[model samples]
Target: MVVSCGLLTANKERVPLKGIEVEVEVKDHVAVVVYTQHYENKEDKAIEAVFVFPLPGDAAVCHFSAKIGQTEIVAEVKEKQEAREEYDDALSSGQQAFLLEESDQSPDIFSLNVGSLPPGESASIRLEYVTELAVEADSGLRFCLPVVLNPRYQPQGSEGHGVKVTAVPASLVPYSLSFSARVSSPREVLKVDSKCSLEPLQYLNKEKTQAVVKLAAGHKFDRDIELFIYYKNAHQPAAVVEAGKAFATPGTIIGDPVMMLSVYPEFSQEVMSSITTSGEFVFLLDRSGSMDGARISSARDTLLLLLKSLPVGCYFNIYSFGSSFEPIFQNSIEYNETTLEKAQKKVEEMRADMGGTEILKPLNHIYSQPCIPGQPRQSAEGTDGHVTVTYTLAGHSFHDKLSFPLQPTEDTGLTVHRLGARTLIRCLETEKGEEVKKKVVEVSVQSGVSSSFTSFIAVNKTSREAIHGPLLQRRIPGVWSRSCYSLSQQAVVPMMLSHSMAKASRMQSHGMARACSMQSHAMAPAAMLQGNTLGVKAKPESLSVMDKVKHLFRPESKCSDDPVPTPAILKHPDSLLQLVSLQKASGCWELNPALAAALNKTSKELEQPKPPKVNGNVWATVLALVWLHAFKLDAQIEWKLLAQKAVSWLTAQNAPSMTECIMAGNTLLGSNVQKDALGL
Candidate 1:
């Protein structure tokens, strides 16, 4: 029989759980889930049970309770410090007590302390939470119950209050979960989809506005439980109004109806481009250890999406932060193809091995950089420390200007609109002891409607009796993937080779022979050798259509050849050639960890293989300029000759568009660049 199991600790003791049952109810787009965990102690002595788990980042917990046979005890919400004191007191007094709270560091992680359970005793803990269903990329309502909790990297200078998740292989987790969901919406239910096995959805009404689905039997908590609910006309704007609790006093905030509005605004591409035609786009990434696993992967994927969608002629830079901050470029640079290729290569090699998430430093640096005229600066940050970072950014001067251009304005506009609306509400009130703007900002930041700030509390006031026993305090571990943590240890892929007059390897395949035969050696203006490794002599050959296409994109092809120089306004051709030589087959450069340490410098300090501590993407851009300087004036024959092919190849390429590379480089440099520009 499958059983719920806590993380495998260094001690090797496994806390076996009985079962997990979840009941969910939906009203329009909001879903309220009641998670019940059953635990039984088989050990000979009394024990404390701790369970670290993941919930939706925005989940608002409203109820917590523990049941012991005939007696039922409920928990009450109090100030964090006070709640901790109460929980500790009950545990010391040997009374059966339970405590639940969100992690101050990460919204997605939470820990439960089940204290004072005697030997052979069993108890049921139930937690109820409410959250708005997120809209998926396909316009469906996405509901996810996370079973896999990855380790979160704590940033330097952050309070070490983030949950410490113990990881194990997925196959070793012994938890059995049974989940059933009821979905209700104003629109007719169209369908439901899930990665997990699910029973066919059942409609509750003929109108098809409501439906229910259940996980198939014999399921384990191996991965997140995900469900997508599609509705008719999902793209249409919509709103839902929920009445306040009946017990709440009338005319108060709790008594008022909670109104949620959704809007999808569209603007012409031209208008959108005109507003952000050229500007600085800064990306701040958190490579702290906690970002290991799916979090980093998701961040990388989001970075790629944003890079591809950038306007053709914008300047951008990346900063990643852990214990410190590093910027890819000392300042933002213009985007183009060759630079983009290098950036993409660097980004693809990023790992969440950076020590901590000290993000403020990078933010300060990014802000300190002088803004260019007619080019606005937009910063986006991505991290698991949502609350801490959001609170920090909310207080920044640039917070108002930082925004997602591609996202619907209403999403952002509403937050500002609501801030204004709340300001109006305060102005309407007779009380004016507090500064009006300050009060409004506080209300907007600390709204009860925000699950981030407030929590639900239920107390069993009827029970006055206390029990006697020694309550064992246990710290429960979440399910972490062992394989993900070791991703940094994987071997790096090797770079492909391309050079002038290089002898082709024995043609095991016809494709290689064709490629070699098509090289256009006769087009070279001179045979110059920078080094034995750089010079290549070859027979003249006809270039095929494919060969020309390959020649245009491949920088390595022109390594030793010098073509006729043309007047160019762009920097040293040799340095540019060296940078091109560093590109891997994936079109990006990566840090050689060994090389960095051998040079007695931190990876961030090393920056590039050449001069000026600019990281990979920036290194490539600087080298391009170095080459451009040679061709800018025809007076320098040797420099121009060497750089001519390099410059031509560089010009033919489009603007750098690989955001992931910028992100990776920034991360390596300990800089803060947000991923929110893509609304990720």
Candidate 2:
């Protein structure tokens, strides 16, 4: 601590010289405390109090208590860096707060911490810094290190101090965040052989298509059960429909079902050491009129932050959709230093234009010529979906009203045509510069951070790069992967994509659709008539008619493996999926896998068990009934007997705590079980 005392004091006979101000600073384990004496009167020596941050553990605050003459002061001591900002709204002595990077500031975010003075007179200030620790792996080749918050103290004198952290294997405390789903169950734990349909749903899109999940457990504490809604789609599931509302948008289709769920059985400590990063994603922004103002601004900020965080060589592209969907041509502008600058500038200059949200235009454009356009589709699914989707492109737009409708087909390659009107949206260009498509488009959910892909691509795996978590890959093919930093809840996809896809009808209006289409006209091959096939994967089990659905929304998963659409997608509620009607295509897409297994069985005793009666909840009983009808309930396994037991289990269910067993169970058990158990 340095303190200077000016020597100029009055000698009796002569005029006194000035006494300059001096400051005193205290250094501690996590913080450096300081006080300055400011001259109330220059004649009285000017004493200044200044706290210089010396610790590295990023802390944004400090504490202070002082007595400078009659000035009775009680104020929070702050690091010089933090004290510089204005905050009349801040707390007086406790809870001093400040933004590490102001919203207006182009912040290169690092870590930040804050501290407080001891609550009594003549006491030392207490300070704390946030830091994270994880296990390390030194396999022959260096695995990427996780990016952890380094704890350091920035006390006026102490530089940020590294925290002594021990990595303790941890598990995410299971949390409960659920709404009453109104699910049902059939059968009890030990008795009841009748097939009682237990249903939790009120009315879903008026489809009346319900599931009768069959379930059973090994024992009471034995929750080895898989209770996902397993069913067959006969042919194909319908396209998405705008059945519910989210984010205050009217007639907006949900990116996921109300019953949709994402479950992380347990928060793994592994999340701390490895880079659980999603694959390299290219964000295709919709700067259409509907995405004006707050949406655009938020997107700009979000994208910039994401660009700043991406891994080096992680590819991406930024395209806008308005009157026309176009990329800033490197032919006209390069991807060089100047080009990136111009690209950012171009983004700043962007204003949502009123134009058509053409489905085929952007996909065809980016696919035919990628920005990094070098890679080819990994499989036939990728290639065909791209080609066919590129064909189904339409310039029509829809807004909140009639935003989407079920599509029988898109003009390009082949598509399952199963999703609804509102489910489709634009594609993200990838490292290969091709449009990364999705089987299940990842729409925005209100969790996780957006990727700073632009920045990620610039990063080199230097040792200094924080060993954060594992870099998650493209679980499947899709451009935009999950975001990393938003710390909301579980990691979630961005909501903007689905929101825009649902609003396509806005551009489809007669007034703007034609003109927008004319401005970006390109010949499409929708004119060529070619019969499309579902590109069925035979080696793998065929996708049950309900490939990605469950009895109710349970988070057995989130699909980052789906294909994304090109150009702009037409949004509607139920994305119409086409079932290859055996009569129409002269092809049987598939039969329910379970039923097939049952049918293929040759055991005489196991053949076609008698139909059972219902007993408990509507969902379980109904599901049991359906399974019996479909697979004819095998008798060897005593499916009817099992169905009866399932009904009895539910009938006696006043209050049961099988949730944990169900959640962790690997069998047919469920969290909030709706329907289950047809013995065999």
Candidate 3:
């Protein structure tokens, strides 16, 4: 039977969450996050609460603990099976136990089972994890706290992991979140910006290396909380040493000071120019139901931009899929004007009506084809679910590295683990060939980085008396997937697609709904249809269901507040001033003698059309413009007035495509702005 925590309580209202408090501390490059959830059983009968949440894919969880009044229980890591058994035993005996485990499918999704709380009792759960902040394409360090866990599409023959997360409207969450972050680094912290409104950054130290930021009051939890942190001399490699716990014995993992190393590898200009200019690019699009709204539109825009940007002699094709798959062209073809036009037409006509999200089949088909010698193959996958499958595909691909298309608190672990020598050797042998085994082993030994598939567990043997009462289980809901469409119109589909999706959804819900070892509540297609299937809360101005569906597909503005959004660089004072300072009286930010030399080019070569590489003048201009767009900065003058000459000069140059200029800007700034939004 399916039990929903969202099911109305005895008073015909949702259960009230006591509170959610998040604390984050950053030391150098690593961030430790702690999430504490307080829950009270106000009802007369005993209750159990299950929370299905999300974390960054690379986060390394190290601690789990629970507290009841003054009694505290600290958990220990064991093998998956062993941990489950102990949790089940504790639950069956009526003693409170909490189980926190990683989902085998997606690294981001996790299920927390807070079991068997007696009537009027309150429990607080604290889970802590550590993760390295990833530097964005724009050189900013990005930190995100996921408020919604979007549903992931599952492939055929895949065993489901974690509880089936029903998508609920955010208003129904019955909880409020309070969060704060403390940041420290060797380099000076320049600024911090967030998608969510934030309180002003408060400096805690005179050196400007330490700061604190908090979420602004009245946040609605409708979207993910994202923070982009900029630092002075960001690319400079640095290391930080954190002293270990004092209570632990010295000379061990718990006692030794942990050092974090950050490195930014630099490549020579000569090496970049040598790479072949022509290659076969394959575009894989996901048209699954989960990809119903903004996701599909984003993919369409991405494809159009990519199609327009292909080199003169490159080859390309498009493959889109749902439950099954299809190819725009039976084989890879040249990316000429006619072919590009044909592919663009097909992409525009594409829809998210392909049934279910099945990616493996098309991937196998693409792999089955013979590769050309000079024309290296590249696959650009566009999807948001089944990330592990994508990882495995990229891991096995010979020519291409995965490019992420788009897109933590706590601490309890005061200890580190032995590098898991055995697991490292096994992973290296299985993933890489024997050729690099010795080198990998040497590095692992020296670096002391822990291996995958190993876990840390803590156990407390103190026991309490058992009480005889009924055991209840409930599945927690998560945020709807970015690709998800309203399920309220399930009956509108053709019978064949309907049947296929029903089967797929049933299988998916079964795998997702499982809480610990308990049976998961299955959601039938009919029931799902009748429910709020849009995966978001209903808005105040209710529109017809059909209108809601149409709104999902509506094209969104690139940037708000303007009919034609200016490039990001035009809005930032530092970047804008840098561009203004680089501009010549001739109305262009020309790569003159001095500027050409800085770019590894001579003034004569800069004027030459296609001088064995990208044109220096256009690139220089784009770089100036791009620099103007990055990060928040203080601007003392009106940039729009000074920007006219450079913009006009740049616009008058017809030699380089806007696509080319954007790509050049991206190369110079390390920013990954999508093609359609380049605003050139």
**Candidate lDDT (C-alpha), each:** 0.48, 0.23, 0.51
Model 1 alpha-carbon miss at residue 195, Å: 1.1
Residue range 334-452, candidate 2, lDDT tens digits: 12334344555565566656454443565455546533332111113221111001111122222211122332223211111111111121112111122322211222111111111
RMSD of 3: 18.0
> How many collisions per candidate?
41, 172, 26
Q: How would you encode candidate 1's per-residue C-alpha lDDT over 34-119 as one tens digit per residue?
A: 99998887666778788878776546555678888877887665545556677677655556667777665444566777776777
Residue-level lDDT for 392 in candidate 2 = 12
> In candidate 2, residue 631 scores what lDDT?
38
* TM-score, cand. 1 vs. native: 0.49
**Model 2, 82: alpha-carbon shift in Å?**
61
> Residue 498's C-alpha lDDT in candidate 2?
19
Please report the TM-score between candidate 3 and the true structure: 0.49
TM-score of each: 0.49, 0.21, 0.49
Per-residue alpha-carbon lDDT of model 3 for 106-179, expressed as tens digits? 44567777777777878888887766554543457767777765434332344444355555676656677899
lDDT, candidate 3, equals 0.51
Model 1 scores a C-alpha lDDT of: 0.48
